[model samples]
Target chain A: MACVVLSLVGISAAPAAEMVRIPAGDYAPPLRAAGEPERVAVAAFLLDERPVTNADFLRFVTAQPKWRRSRIAPVFTDEAYLQHWAGDLELGPLAPPCAPVVRVSWFAARAYARWAGKRLATTAEWELAAAAGFTRADGKNDPELKHAVQQWIAWPVPAILPDAKRARPDFNGVRGLHGLVWEWVEDFSTAMVTGESRGDSGLDRDLFCGAGAVGSRDPGDYAAFMRLALRSSLTARHTTTSLGFRCARDVPEDSSP
Target chain B: MKATAWLCTVLFAAAAMAAPPPMEDCCKEAPPAGPVSARSIYQLDATFCSDTGQCLPLAALRGRPVVLAMFFASCGYACPRLVTDMQAIRGRLPAELRDRAAYVLVSFDPDRDTPAALADYRRQRALDGAWMLLRADSGAVAELAALLGVKYRREPSGNFAHSNLITILNPEGEIVHRREGLGGGLDEAAQAVVAVGKGK
Candidate 1:
């Protein structure tokens, strides 16, 4: 199943219309690694730049009846937390719903994506969309497109973001990955750097510096620290700033099946 | 001898009549070990000895009901508050259950809470016959505390560092639920016991 990045207006826009997709297998990894063979199809769309506003989330809450006045587990007990995420929002003449939403926990983000008939983009898939990489939707490579994209990334983020929806002609299509609010990704089980789960929860004693990734001494493996600290935080815990999410989809099974 | 025997019977009847209602809902775990029809508590088999009374093995409560908790008779703050909490929970139970359940308050301050002290504490709570303030040997108390995951450390200021919590055991000697912090909702706790008692 190809992940569709459609505009809320149902427009599939200019650069995207002209763009050809490279078949899923075209991009090669920089570093050879285990689990590389496992393919995770990712599809993401450009946002209107800022995180989705409170109004956008409110639409989601209203659509999904079960989310209203929810009885989330202990992690969601904080009343203030519930209100912040479930802010009062209605369509406004000037208010923007297409903007990104912030102050969202990884749990909350995952729930919202699931409710919306989509899945979160794994970090690799997200990187592929954001950074210079082969277009894996079709079996083709335009080196000119790849070079131009690399050059644009090398260019410092423009003082003004080129409209994310309108992919720059010099580069392939994607928007708001770098310098935007940190996006929550899937693969919660994988630490960012080492790609391993961390900590001593009863559920993961085997990975508790036991037999797994604990053997690494390089300081770059500090992703474990970030993962464990992130896990300790309550599910509903979120600051009203600087956190958001994008989504992905599994390629159609019939295509492979 | 017949008149004396009659007098002894009368006194025994009076004592039983005046017994305090048992403490219900002590030392329990929730999200029961198996299915979730209705029960919610973790249970344990414990033996509580009154400071001077014989050790009462929890097996006796199997087929009978009981409530259990922790305390140091010498505690000045939350410990006394816990007694009030447990008593409130007891008052809410049906009298039939009230008569069947045993309230076990095992003392953690063994160095100072002797059997005599426990008896005095029981009287203060007006336990009459409803509950027993137990005083196990220091070793026994430690062993009991460890099994329940209750921790207590005496502070220099005389106050104890301990959580105010309650445990509920079913009539079958299994813990059905637990409520932690001084913010326990006892009525909710009672429901936990009844659900377990009925084996739901």
Candidate 2:
């Protein structure tokens, strides 16, 4: 009986090192202005292995009353914020403790990252990490990974999400970079798309200054295009049913876990 | 003991009923010392530095109507036009309402636009005391831009590509009106300021 109790405690405490180290890499943005570089360099960083879960966010809202569903300011989130939860402090049938928390606004996600002593990954870092294949560093040439990603994109989200921990790990031992949910990056508002696909060839110059020179780099990368479209369409206070977030940290100087 | 308590309550009620209601103090400059409204931008806890190098919080502007925009000084296009548009809005307001409103400019390039730079820009633009030029750390600037629905990106050439928007905030620090795509809407923005100032 004592051994079983000890093992249970061990299971609960195992998340201490749940972050995976992503190596320094380069990310090519799908869209860029004429003067902007094609590839942006990303430094080494620590990314959470899975998305932040319902149980994890519950502890945050409970400890910080300002973030609770009933108490959060309207400026930080819309009315749909945390609409899936059973009550201010309860998770209903639709939400499972281990499932990635959804329906959270960008402001709420940013505040949670600050509380966790981490930050939302920049677009360059996130794209670089997500570019990896399951078995290789560059997923662009991996047919199997490409097929899996396309299939996931085609399917509709399930009514209730599966456990975030169940997602398969990729080359860098990170999970849920794709085929789970859309995420909030730190600079999502920088996407700058004009909403009309044809207008993207030369962004609406009147609406956005210096955007007249912007154009797409790769029309064949459907997945990256979709992510950019979603990001540009969003306002900071808006939340969707499938939108969630994970945290990232700068790798420590000493390199110790 | 019960009779004594009942007598005390009756005496207190009689005294309260005899007193007149408190007058509304129209000249009061400070906001009430309580929680801000749920939708107020003053709920943001970020601090900013004015052109004069004074540290100021968003809450400090709580009691006045604010006409705010985000821009950088070195931009050769759009930013100069945005400032001129703000000046137009200020001109449209009645002289009485003009003096009561605050025109604020926040910089997107925190790295380059220090307090000294902002002060120089103010002097060149000939902005009066009613105008405030402010800059903050990048994080605070990003948060404020996000709240105002402004999208901006720094170019390799050190210039910024940003949305052309000017926002009018009421005395409570809630966004009351927005003028998008520039060169027009100065009349409407001035009307909004007048409405908010008069309502207050």
Candidate 3:
């Protein structure tokens, strides 16, 4: 499967679409239940080469005016959603045109992805893709990558974003995944480190049969744990300065299956 | 000024004529009466298959207030009590008000919680006419879970670790209140249902 930039009507007006083809591979994520398979199979998919920029989102809102900040429903977003934008259509001085857009709620992100005929990457898929380093596809075992992620997590967020493509790309040709904004995963809500169901609730154990064994598989994987924690704490309507998202697409049948 | 006043009067009259009748009686099972609000959960275009083999958009339940929760049929731990808590809350409502409210249990395990499975679970739980056991496709499940703010993950073992939340939605499908955790007092939820049922 080849990843190429396709000019789509609803998503972007830019000359080149930024997408990368991720090959199908086996991923051993940090959060796994005991007795589960050691590796999970991830199907080949298309991912945005860089995070969605303010300009890209501007085009989306321009095409579908209902998604404009002023007109959006309260149910889909919190008060802070798109507050950084100077106006509904304007990116303002703080957000540069090429900077990754922030302060977008999960609902807004999902809608944007839908408008683009793409979908948000699942938590597993995001983790799998982010595991790549400069040289290797599966860098979960790389202490340097893990340390870099931790360092990024500790730093204060920059007031102004530089550019979506400023950071170097990873082995998969995906860029700015780690040292940039936290992404909105498709199944972010499913990161249930803490919620209504617990082993104490006998039925929850039955419902999530092996969940007792499903905690951090590698306690040393602090970066992964932090990401999981942040995701679970979020609501669909909540937005933040450090969170943004890119889009993904399943491989077409003729190309892969 | 005279023409503007006349126009205002005409517009007001049209709006009043278009207005739905006030739901004064908490017990009346009104048909879905108005356009769904932009914020309403019913805005989601998801189809749900009930235990009794009734397949319809979740919006079909818009005519009455609903108490909603998510669980899989085979959950061995907290789900049974979650159902009981739902039952307890429904029981606390006045009989007339009870008839106007719905108790909805949406299964997170759609693969196993088929219509047949949901039906069997409903039968075993002795759910009454006031209750609906529902299953949908995975995409619908994710959307509903996101809207409801209930987190869940299916383990490799086919069980789901889920958050326990009971959400109360008005007849318009707007979430009015939520009770979190396992097996808490249903008083708050019950009160919210009555208030919503009475169009408060």
Candidate 4:
């Protein structure tokens, strides 16, 4: 066990995980109340090229026993957290070391990011980064990117996941932003779609104070709507087999490597 | 030089593995005598500052039935009503349970609702010592809100759009009941607090 831990540490120290710069841009929130800004300005930031891998998480749990699957507090996560792993320190067959770590609650993900000296991307930043195409800044007009996103949504997740590092890079050289997994953002709770879609057009003012005069910017954008719906449906402690997350950081003024 | 660096990394990793789990800033206080319940919110290690500027862990509220809600002091619409509803629940409780219960309001706007601001809010609301107005950093506030299943967002206008929720916690810090969306649930919520307080 000691040798295994040492080797994993060695691997992580070999090269720091790649981070891609997402240039400053604007994010159009898919759904917003009437008085909300139409487009939110997002500053430039650094986002991890791929999601955190199982091996990386194994190292974290090995060092921080409180966060280990068996030791985590029930209030922080549901029963299914890291249920796929064989044991506290072992990934086993179901979760390949290189595969993106899944079944992580938002709190657990945030802790991992904090440990790594980074933070989860916000909804606006994540949306801005994911909006890029393979060849251009705007993915909305790119037929190929649109087709890939739609295709991925139509398919069910395979029993065993593939290597996260192998995903194709998008325009900003960031990979797995769309086709790999549903990522957790920093302010996911802010996506306030009421439980009943029928009442979403006009939010229930009683249940959610000041959720006034809400409307979708583009109802035809099924992907954005789906993301918003998924976010809204999740509680912070809830985790799923298909959900994972990547970290983001502020770009320093001098841009040191 | 490279080999030395690798050896240093190995030693650092070993030291980290051997050390106790990292504690949050608010966990410096001596922990409670025994293990908290697995499902208890007191298991959270984050600290919060009361309106009086005293820092304390959530565990400090243990052994007292607590009526808790998350609100921003500047909220114009639902927050005032939420406080009123809480007071009404306290009114409904049996006299013994009423004085024993703790009324807690945790702020969502950490940037705006400083300890002083929370103190001002206490004065404005005429909340007495039994009522605890608390504020913490954004990270700690977010974690507490997550545990309570409260969702809030700061709008561009600086007011918060939030879920109106009132939670009842037993002496052990486990949630016994939750009143969602305000108004009518006060009777049931009060009964829940009574039940938990009397150990029914």
Top model by TM-score, which number? 2
Q: How does residue A59 of candidate 3 score in lDDT?
A: 88
Better of 1 and 2 by lDDT: 2
Task: Assess candidate 4 and give its TM-score to the true structure.
Answer: 0.87
- List, residue by residue over B63-120, the lDDT tens digit for candidate 3: 7889999999998877888898898998899988886688999999989998899888
Q: Judging by DockQ, tell me the better candidate of 3 and 4.
A: 4
lDDT of 2 by residue, B1-200 (tens): 99999999999999878865455543456576678889998888799899898898988888889999999989888988999999999899888778778999999998999888999999999999999998998878888998887889898899999888889999989999988775878889989899898844
- Clash pairs, candidate 4, are none
Against the true structure, what is each candidate's TM-score?
0.36, 0.88, 0.81, 0.87
lDDT (Cα, 0-100) at A193 in candidate 1: 28
* Model 4 segments more than 4 A misplaced: A1-16, A195-203, A253-257, B1-32
Residue A251 in candidate 1, Cα distance off native in Å = 2.4
Model 2 iRMS: 2.2
What does candidate 1's lDDT look like per residue over B109-147, in tens digits? 777887788888877878867687776554355434433
Tens digits of per-residue lDDT, candidate 2, A1-41, equal 99788557534532332888999999889999897898988
Per-prediction DockQ? 0.02, 0.48, 0.30, 0.48
Extract clashing residue pairs from model 2: none
lDDT per residue as tens, model 1, A187-229: 3323312222212222222112111212222333132233334
